[model samples]
Target: MGHVTFFGVVTFVFRHSAGCTGNAISSPHRCILVPSFEIKGKNSMPKMYRTKLAAMVKNFPRYASANQPPNGEIRSYIESAGHTCELRDAGEFQSPADVVNLVSEHPKFEAALAIHLFKAGRLLMDIEIPFGVIFGGTDINEDVKVEQKRVVMEQVLLKARFAVAFTDKLKEEAELFLVSQSSKIYVQPQGIQTDVTEKFCWTEFLRSSGVRTEHVDELRVFLLVCGLRRVKDPLYLVEVFSKWHCENLLNVLVIIGPKIDPVLTAEVETVVKRTAGVFLAQERCQQELHAAMKRCFAVVNSSVSEGMSAAILEAMDLGVPVLARNIPGNAAVVQHEVTGLLYSSPQEFVRQSQRLLSDHELRERVVRNGKLYVEEHHGVKQERETYQRLVDTLH
Candidate 1:
């Protein structure tokens, strides 16, 4: 054994000749403190393995940061499981060679995990690294509809060592693209950590947004949290609310999400201006957002598509019933009238909203069931264990 130094929890090889067998030691916590190495020759270069992670969207920090999304969640899980991992920005890499250069430089990285297959599949082929892929919404829903994206996605799926999806529906969809290795498909839902506070600061948020707390006292408010993008359909409910706005009804729709697409943001603003009682607001911090979810009568998701929506799960975790679109992703979590109500069109959405708003018993029952649904199915511990089992097989 050669002299070793601690870098972090994991071990690293240092100043060793090439072609030497290195001993990598990991603690029970999966922290690598010192790496083992064998020297081949003074001229031989050290081998390094790098894991590259990618997401198509840029504003993830606004909502997810280090706390949300299974991507960040799995990164933490893998790190705690005793692997030296690095999160590479696949968005920053301009070309295939750039990605190849980045991944090829890292030593001891035997495989890489891509959050979405489309982003990682081709890159893995270019670099010739064993890659595991996870499916996102569009990959199975919209992208597969198009011949080009579908063909590319199929190639990626065929090349992947294993593929993960957020729902069983997605796993079945993956079977269509991955004709050869259907057994490699796995279903892993996104996990959320709930926040509980006796005091909620809705008054402060309303004040900052230029709405008087006095006005809030008399009105029924509903909160919609999602990025302003085509997939999310942020303006759908705003359009529906325009017809129902009445002084006697005294209801307001507050849409709060990061402005992702400029065109979509402009369209949302147009709807907000045209629709009375519809307020378009910027994104809120997790604490504030959770508080809003707690205070609101119901949380809504008008997404045209999704892969196990985190927003729906979060709302459910907070004992808030959901009003979601009747899509595969929404149906996977919400049991129609059992946990939440689902609608097909804007008119149906209004009808469902009317029923939930007028009936207190229905609302309370759904809220109770929604919370139970999240606790049983989408807990953070359950998500972590699933990934641990998958990675344990790899080791």
Candidate 2:
């Protein structure tokens, strides 16, 4: 066994007779770590039979990072159960047969998990492996609305050993489309860990991201964290945010996430170039991003849909106020005026954001309640236990 550290992250590597066993620790960047374990049986030291676990994650640079929460958290929980998991990029394969062919070359896997129902799950349908699908934000909120995507997702759900939804609202929405497998759908909110490092420097982040130094002293930052994609609607508030910025010159909306969609990324770049008080910061490690969120007046979410946002939960855990779009996925967690503020349109967002920034009492009340909500509902221990039980069913 040996270890390697990269990008300030440490990973353990262990060699096995069959090959190396590992799982990625998401964050600044992916760091694969292999755990040491021994398979057990009754009397004698039984021949070790490692429980091969395969995970297919969303194909995006951010998803590949150690700070993304979902994949890394799941991998950690699976490993804690004494299983060996290898996470692969689902986008690398062409079809279900391709996935099967790749897995066939490895040790017979006991179970497999795919990140998104409509994306990765559909590709794993015909694979000769017992697998489960986890509904991403788009799977329930966007993909299910498209007839073709919905049909394929329902088929995948039917073939799936089980399906996981991050929230009960999401489970209910999915059931409306996949009624037959409603019994197998489980609700497990994404576990969150806000581990912000003290090394984070807000001034340096602003300087590197092209934020104007002249306005730094009076800047009131609202961090909008989302990958640049159509579904995420990263630029939904760009025009209005810029207009408001011109009016006050105090508020700035800093968008941060990976470039998942090139066309959208280009559009965002164009908008940021012209829009005053609106900046696009490169994606930071989870800890650094959360630390930045803490520095901001509030965290914003402008997604068209969500499957329980780990970002929102992380902001709440960090005691940062949340301002999210009024979608079911966001609503399920943000109880308007309670845990966080929810808005339906750009104008509503502006109005609510102003209130959050001006009303000290409102901000304090909501931030306090949001932290409590996460502690009471999204406890990491509870999420770990629930996933462990789900993995047990695979046996």
Candidate 3:
């Protein structure tokens, strides 16, 4: 209800046009627009909940943003507010048998919060503790399609002390897969923080990314950030992007992120070697990545599905306009023309990318709006406080 300026106007027009309700947005710096449900007591100060927690994360050495989730943030929020937290990496939601065997020997904690439903939640089904579950990108979108996983996920939900969703759209998509647990599902958008490295070397980055030194400033770099995985559909736009680069040598497309999947990584490497003007950049630290993003013309998201993209949010925070594949999760963050451009097809993606290159007014508007959206809705303080409040349910 504040800042009724151009940002508000842009948000209002889009929400109405898309028939979005008051509660339809999210912030990863996602801008989910949902308020945190606090746990204030009557009269006296509210009691703080403090205890050790076994927070589960996608702990893969080749993963870029595994720690970029509610579990990672909540660990600090809980500890800083007077509690201890331990992170357990159960990468890829494989079998929970290994984790279950380990927790059986560890010291007990007060409560727990896990990122993926089946991975962490199911891991603790027999651990005997109150816990909350945060949905992941593939959890609600792809994995739940199978009947067995769907049933187990539902069971996880039925037993969880609480569940967190990055956006309302994800919550709805979840409802279609299982019986509605609207009462316990919290639409708390993930919070993102960006920090760039000091004196980052663009030339070094280019060299590492397989770009020629002579063509540093001559090329317009459009970065695609994603961990190499099947669900991410890293190759969805590669063929088209390669074609675009062939037509215009100045148009460079770089895929930068961790090699999450060995098979997918080999496939991507082969394509990049054979492709024109498309390179695979080395994975940089979070700070370096942010710095590289600043130099790029724009950021891109070609994920088949996303709960919310920390990369896109980081790009917007760094004043880089995003060109995202049009999917429900991406759409929740990007308001098409208002915040960023969305493309349903690779052809549309090229068209939008060109607009960002040639249409100054359009690009400027989106960049400004994207930054405003991130600031207004997503903040470290906001997410921390919200998680603290949600975790209080275990008390």
lDDT of 2 by residue, 163-231 (tens): 777888778888887656778998887776678889998898987888866657578889888877777
Ten contiguous residues minimizing lDDT sum, candidate 1: 34-43
| TM-score of every candidate relative to the true structure | 0.82, 0.86, 0.84
The residue-by-residue lDDT of candidate 1 on 193-292, one tens digit each, is 7665656677766555444446776767777778777888888777667677654356777887777678888988876776677887666666667888
Alpha-carbon shift of residue 367 in model 2 (angstroms):
0.5
Error of 3 at 106 (Å): 5.3
Best-fitting candidate, scored by TM-score: 2
Question: Which one wins by TM-score: 1 or 3?
Answer: 3
Q: Count the backbone clashes (under 3 Å) in each candidate.
A: 23, 6, 7
List where candidate 2 sits over 4 angstroms from the true fold.
1-50, 59-69, 214-217
Ranking by lDDT: 2, 3, 1
**Root-mean-square deviation of candidate 3:** 11.8
For model 3, how does the per-residue alpha-carbon lDDT over 54-155 read when each residue is reduced to its tens digit? 555553221254223633345556544444454545542245554344333323344556666765556656545566777875778877988898888898
In model 3, which range of ten residues has the least summed lDDT? 4-13
Model 2: ten consecutive residues of lowest lDDT: 36-45
Better of 2 and 3 by lDDT: 2
